[model samples]
Target: MSPGADAPDTGRFALRGRIVTLDPADTVLDDGVLYVSGTLIEAVLPATAPAPPGFAGVTPLDTRGSVYPGLIELHNHLPYDVLPLWQVPKRYGNRSQWGGSGNPAYRTLVTGPMKVLGQDPRLMPAVVRYVEAKALVNGTTTSQGIALFSNAGARRMYRGVVRNVEQTDTPDLPEAASRIADVEAKDAEKFLARLKQPHRLLLHLAEGTDAAARAHFQALQFQPGKWAITENLVGIHCTGLNADDFTVFAAHGGSMVWSPLSNLLLYGKTADIAAAKEAGVLMGLGSDWSVSGSKGLLGELKAARLASTAAGSVFSDRELVAMVTRDAARILRWESALGSLGAGMRADLVVVAGTHGDPYTSLVDARDEDIRLVAVDGVARYGSGRLMRALAPGENLEPVPGTAGEHVLRLDDGTADTIVAGLSLGEATERLAGALADLPALAATPVPPITASPGGGVRWQLALDEIEPTGAELRPRLPLLSASGETHPTGPGIGALTAAPAELEPVALDALTASDDPVFLATLAGEGNLPADYAGALARLLT
Candidate 1:
């Protein structure tokens, strides 16, 4: 924004920081310059290098922190993230045992409520606005898209400030599928054939600690030694898989996404990550959802570190950080364009509060308050007030709550979905919290336009994947035998919401960022499934 800046129309600017480029050699420049032009990174050079052509007159931003690629969350149910953490009722053996249909606690606490929220046209925009903002505060640039349904049951992806892996209109950013066609899912042969067509398909696999959960994976071997997994099949939470199972997964070019906290909270244990590592399986970390999981990938990283230590320091800070950065991009088949800071790549990166200590740990251990800036496609979306004023002036910035009011968010740019425009963060938080507090009222209320809706007049209600049927399932309940030798799916699928809620169960809205949640640390420590040492260590670190 300097006086002599050349061609501001190109949106050219320079950011200087301690860059941690996760290139092939893992390059780190103590004082680096990230030159950006429009939507792509022009070059990553040292501060001593001569300024790039168009950046000569533009004043460079001294981030005064360590810079890394924006965190890419491979797995998350974003809409459900508005709900607070679930107080697990008991240790369940498998996904089927505590099916969203059978368990009153899950049905009443999780699925039933989401069903109402996702179906309401008037409240749908609030769901999209709140969750996407939550992702921004936590430094996540890309995540799974929210699937919406029309009155006639037409499906569409929710477009928002956050880059959705499900749909990216541009060719460089290939669209990944979180939901496949119904035809592809019901048949094993069809699912395998879809994997061979060259695209990343994220599906939940073996999500429990019992034999029934393991059977979901075992059934993938349609015939002896012939598995349905391929590099394109990115399984979410292979908790039920054994060391040998990971060997097979890697052998078939498959990868895995781990949500340690969610697994530990539901079952008594999590995946045997050490075994997967031994088998050379590529793994990425996901926050899953706010209920029974970390608020975001930042908290997820801390939980991962704790779990890693309990497993005898199985992964270093560098490896754990990579899961959400470099490794995560690779899982989505986008290594060349994102998940790393490189020339000609997308300008998606984050700046944390420090330039000292282990750079990798700086990012892995950071909280929301410690984040200095988050830029996606070279546009500042969230950051400290000073940085936002400089990077995104006249963009109608809103103060991001849960950061002690220190950080601000700018979503009014062309980036935001039309449904989210003109909607303040405060309004979205209030309406969503109030709706969750009274589920019965929300379900019974008419869909007529209310004064609070910010969508102008567009009624946008996306079907919540895994809750309501949206063509295909996010987690495949592949065919397997039940304990009674009944042929059925080993894992649970979209369960029937048997009846309407009879009572008004008040549920607290989940905290926007982990750093601001008063009880977030305590809840992690109190989880009965986590080992005493792991729980204690996490508490002490956060405290």
Candidate 2:
């Protein structure tokens, strides 16, 4: 271990305060003093401990107020910048009453919004600023985001669209398509690349079925130790994978992010949780796009606890917190830098007023408002007011805007505790929903079907009468009405049905050979054609 590069440098600083230090073990230090230097934890001494000699330059932090390590969001999407309150159904007239106040346009306007947002850089910055503002206030310092259309897809789409346009005689149509593709490619690449520089990046590479899922993984060549090297890339919500997929992911010793709520909402099912655990894969949980239900990761944890309990799972509440904290740090490969309140780790911490009543129970049941202060890399992001006031002298106290005095929270026992800060239940729900409302739509307008090959077999090519953008999941049912007015029960694969003229051969071969089960092949007359490799992949599956 080359002294873990992320370790703190040599120096001595005392953090004497109520510290919820998630260290080698979960420990709450009352009037505790932690001495650190050069990025490593030197010692966790009592506040009464004498200051080490020759440590004169050390800044004594009067944390008698609050301090803790930075928080970790194991599974998040970085480049997929969702606006706060933008993609809601309120913007669309066709949306129904059942759509609820949540962002209903998410499924409808995914393509247009993705295309437009993808074209602009400021869009991401603006969204991130808002989200970061909210996250800091809530004590979330590090997050793993699995952004949409990774760099690879963006590059391919760019080349494909450019080629498609250059070969076309129609200037306006070609230029439009080319521009859209160009924007998507550039935006995705730039954001993903930028996210990679951060300490924690989980960029999601989610695909629908096993085959498509495998396609994305295969694109990476499943190399071992890749994620560890970069210390980024947390694979979230992966499903329908074969044993080989697990082997590859495990080889890198990367973290697995399971978003049960988001998965259930979008797809009918979620990943094989039990299977993931059996493979010794480090696990973490995320709330995902829980705003639709007016929830966050804490709510996600409760849901996970119930689901796991129903399944007879043995993971404890401490284990659960690890998913959001310690385990999450492992996923980001930032264990040395975050996840615990060791001496070397940044003094980024959180204080929940006071520690009493089953710690685990309190954490699970507590609302986001329970959080006191949030620090990032030794700097206070939120809840700095009370901490600063407690540490500095009264005469030295200057006018602080957001730094209000400590709040007195009344408990059920008719007693009250004066705490510096906390999150409100109502506010948390409102803020999360408001944030979700900004997400791009995933649904698209249904178009007329264009038939391609109605050959001898049950094969019939079907194309969307128009171009429609797809999301993480693509499920389209083509109505195959026969001459007698009876509809055929058969529906072809999306790739096969939408295959353009150039893609016909491969799509046909794939449908014919991809699976042991018989496949019905079809193609839409004029959509972007499929390629030969796709047919080859399908052929391998069949064989």
Candidate 3:
């Protein structure tokens, strides 16, 4: 959904909770009451204040949690959810080496079987839907990535930030672009020109410590006289960037999206975030993909916090939260409607259980189990089964048990059924393991030998000169690059492609793969005070 456009008025209702409004000054209302009229926020008032005259009959949804703006994931590769924590034996010099013919795992696990599965039109959509559900369960209301599923003529199955239209064909120039290598000098000039208009250009720059990665940053830097606009640029990874590079990026108003966990796992190092912060370059958080990143944005937030702390330049809890909310929205140019909680803003909100006096602390420490509700456009799309029942009595709410014996609420939105259940930070990983266990045996392909030149160029060949051929036959599973000259798993590793055929039961498979539900304790409007035993109330609700 485009930012700020009023969604069709579903109806009016009130949500009362401890609100943490990410206003200019970071306001906190211990007992805040937000009135929603249709898709827009009608008012944000103290709970002690009287309700507006027109809201007399509307029921209030009382939550024992803190309500804030929905989290915005600025970067992600959603289809990679099928694979959990996949990596080679050792770090490669660059991303190309990791995915190229040089890596045996890439050839067998990803390129060979996975590629074959991805070609299946039926299976691809199921995989994409599962990834989206993972994001929603983690409290991500708005996420940006290459759209793999078509929602045309169907009710939007994946609720958060649906911008699926391919922008490459736009004559006026695309609103966003990615992958720095794809942009040549001419393309960069065109990108600069587009910056004059409303545009955002994202690139995977400085992703590794190798010279090739460093050169990518140089290619992205503005030439003294050739280019000038940098405000619309967003660089992802940036692990190899130095102080001078940070200075240049900040001077031009360029921002960066940090994937700390992915960076650390890939290169054993992350960006100089402290220097970037000091340079005044805005930073947003992202989970690169399931292969090298945490489960989702919530897990990524914890990783970012730990990384920052280890670097001796810790971000405040509020500042860390803003990185995924306001700061990210600003980068996406959706700040007006998506980031903060205020009257007239789009009602994209998240509620998480927290007992601390400081809401920021609770948010920082919140696991998926802490999240009680996540709403987009004034609709409660995901929450506990109990909350979903109260929010939309007309819709069917089914309880699906996760691997850990936790129940998740699964809802169907016409197009596809989505698991809106609360998941612990590690639940997705556990489910992914179970899903993979159902797969058939994957055939192994011989690893292609890679010869490196002194100039850092890699040459891949079927056989090396020093090695003698044995009686054993060798077969190359798939070409390193496809017919279109694109690498396998173009955006991210597609894991479901290689799974066993018998396990392709989409509905049943997803149900068995649902994550654990969170603890939820809420009172419907007009109810008396919360039960004295809050834990007991939550336990009863879960049962």
Candidate 4:
């Protein structure tokens, strides 16, 4: 949906909290009040400051927590949510060495399962929803990855998806022109020319700890007869690049995306972050994929801290936070629209319990449960059940089972509707373990061998049926409300709500249930929560 649609005419509301604005000045307000007008942030001021002259009747949403801009995940593969960590018998020098053609375990476990799942169009949306929920619960509001679902409707699930650069033969300038075949070089040239356009160019380059991996950066730099690197270039996992390589990249206005968890898992080492930073390369953080990475960007942030410390480079908590927020947005060329909490910018934000003296430190230490609210464009999409009701009273709120106080709010774009709540990080992952249980292709596919004898080789076997549901059983259980506006025990079916809230009258239960609008009432029940005062304000809101 276009961000403007269903843009809650929040007429005017002041989100009061401890604000951490990752602005150019790194402004932090101990007790801040952010006034939001529709989808834009109208003003950010101190809690004691009076409301601006024009916003007289604005409702105050007391977040009572630490508020900050939503995080940006610069790189990820959403579809890879289906795969668990699959270790091979031996390590390889680079991704190509293992992923290209050498490893039987990769083929049998990673590639084989993906190919099988890709054949079924029916399962793609489910996988997409799973991954999007995984990111949202972790406080990530923006994510960029290769498009997996063709449905435009899926785009409404998140705040934004970075537009993908068209794939060409060079996919991502693999190696220097001379090192690659003639046909590949021609493809790389074609790809490089398109970089002149205004879109962010992303590619996985030098992602290993070997000479060949480091050489990829050289190939990109001297590409023989191609255009030079530009600011649009975003290199992912530069595990092999050295200090000199980073200098060359920074000189050409290139940025790097750090996926330390994945790098450490696959290559036993990560990028020379100290070198990259010293060379003035803009850095962003990403949660590569579940296969070899942390659960999401939150976990990845911790990994980045550990990696930075081990490398003898100390990045303050605020700097680390910027890597996922402001710096990441700059890398994607979205600085004008996102990255910081400011007036005239979209209200994509995250609210967590304020437990530390420093907001940035609190953010780095936050868990999924600590996330009190996550909003995109002024609309609260996920948060505590009470918070969701207070923010968007008329909209439907679905309980995110397995989470102590979490819930998902439904969003309706004029064309379609999508949900934004998810299982807690751990619960979401547990659900993924059995995602392939019903896919027959997994069982039908043949397993390749790492050794000569069948018994000595690793096999592609999963006890799918043994996996249990990770969260609460989701059955359509709608609470029945009496004519007096009191919530009653949930009944067997939605048949109890025969009349829409707008049509209900002050009468006995029998008369209320016999009124017209059963269809509309049933629809509300399916979506979930219906407040006690829903019949009064919500009736007008829904109509």
Best by lDDT: 1
Order of candidate numbers by TM-score, starting with the best: 1, 3, 4, 2
**When superposed on Cα atoms, how far off is each prediction in RMSD?**
4.4, 19.3, 13.1, 20.4
lDDT by residue (1-543, candidate 2, tens digit) is: 011122223244456666556666688666676666543446666677776655556766664344455555554332232321121222121111112223333323332333333333323223323333334433455543222222222322111000111122222111111112222222333333433453333434433343434344444431233322123445666654455566666665645777764444333345666656766678887655422211245455655665455446746777776787777666645566567777556454555554455555555554444555554434333444555444322322222122224421110111111110132322333433332344333112222222233452221111111113333212122122345654444222222223221100101111101111123111111112222233233223212
lDDT of each: 0.80, 0.40, 0.58, 0.58
Residues 35-82, model 1: lDDT tens digits? 888878888999999988878887778999998998899999888888
lDDT for position 436 in model 1: 81
Stretches of candidate 4 exceeding 4 Å from the true structure = 1-11, 87-90, 145-191, 223-227, 409-413, 417-435, 438-543
Number of clashes recorded per candidate:
2, 39, 3, 1
TM-score computed on alpha carbons, candidate 2: 0.51
Better of 1 and 4 by TM-score: 1
Candidate scoring better on TM-score of 2 and 4: 4
The C-alpha local distance difference test score for the whole of candidate 3 amounts to 0.58
For model 3, the superposed segments whose C-alpha errors exceed 4 Å read: 1-9, 146-187, 225-229, 403-411, 414-543
What does candidate 4's lDDT look like per residue over 1-543, in tens digits?
123344455566678889899999999988888888877788899878888767778766788799888888777765564555434344456665555333444444554455444433333333444555556666777665323222221211222221211221122212111011223322334345545565666667677889766655555533343334677677888888999888888887888889986776566678888899899999999878765665567667766776776778558889999998889877765677678988877677889887358888788777666778888767777788777888878776656544545566443333222322332333433333444543343436433322234344322221111011112111111222345644454222211112221211111010001012243333323322222332233222222
Give the winner by TM-score: 2 or 3: 3
Estimate, for each residue in 1-543, the C-alpha lDDT of model 3 and write its tens digit: 222233334588888888888988888889888888777788888988888767988777887789989887767766555554554366655565565544555544444433323323333334554666667777787665433222121112233233221132222213464422222322445555645555676656667877656655654434443433378778788887888788888887789999987776666668898888888889888887765665677777776777777688568878899998888878766677667888888788888876457888778677667777777777776676656667767764444345332324433443222322233223444444443453343122222223333664432111110012221111111113334544342232212223232222211122222134221111111122212342232233232
